[model samples]
Target: MRAGTLIATDSGNTLAAVRRCEGSLERMRGLLWRPALVPGQGLLIAPCNSVHTIGMRYAIDVVFLDRDGRVLKVCPALKPLRMAMARGARQVIELAAGEASRLGLLPKRVVRWQETLTA
Candidate 1:
């Protein structure tokens, strides 16, 4: 699926908007020069297990997910110049600070894109 907002159907946790980073170059430059992440805005990097905030300008919340979109872990308020990892994560989501808690994005929670009905 093309990149979009991923909402938790069961818990109503909304992950704002999302930008995809799949290729090596895209993944490597994930959120590097962004000034800030608005609430509900995030970066989704696929096939990633670890991430570093070496050049990030602000802190963010991180959600690690498996291939099936089940959350593997959640790291809140991860500051810049830091790093984190999830052993079995196939995707990593980076969100604005506190967005994770507000959305109740917890481990095992399944996240998916909302389907919009056609006219």
Candidate 2:
């Protein structure tokens, strides 16, 4: 998975630092063994509309995005063993619990993914 960040183009503010989990294996392993995501950290699963937290160690905020990076839905503080989905969503971002709200990632807001510099 390649690391990146989600930024609001309108405000030029960062929403979160994320890793692109595009492959099936990568998406399947989503937050399974993680204790919790630190602030500003998240996972991006492309071509996804639904997600399950059956084996996640901690709750998370699920932000659904349309093909154009528009926020479609947000499932906040989704606890373990839960699932969330949004119609017409092309990607899902698994953020730390409350991270979406803290970053103002509300429905209709726009965000763009940018690959950050890596050493």
**Per-residue lDDT of model 2, residues 25-114, tens digit only:** 887888888668889899999889999999777889999999999999999999999999999999999988999999999999999899
Q: By how many angstroms RMSD does model 1 differ from the true structure? A: 2.7
Predicted structure with the largest lDDT when compared to the true one: 2
lDDT of 1 by residue, 36-78 (tens): 8888778888889999999877899999999888999999999
TM-scores for every predicted model: 0.86, 0.94
User: What is the alpha-carbon lDDT for the whole of candidate 1?
Assistant: 0.83
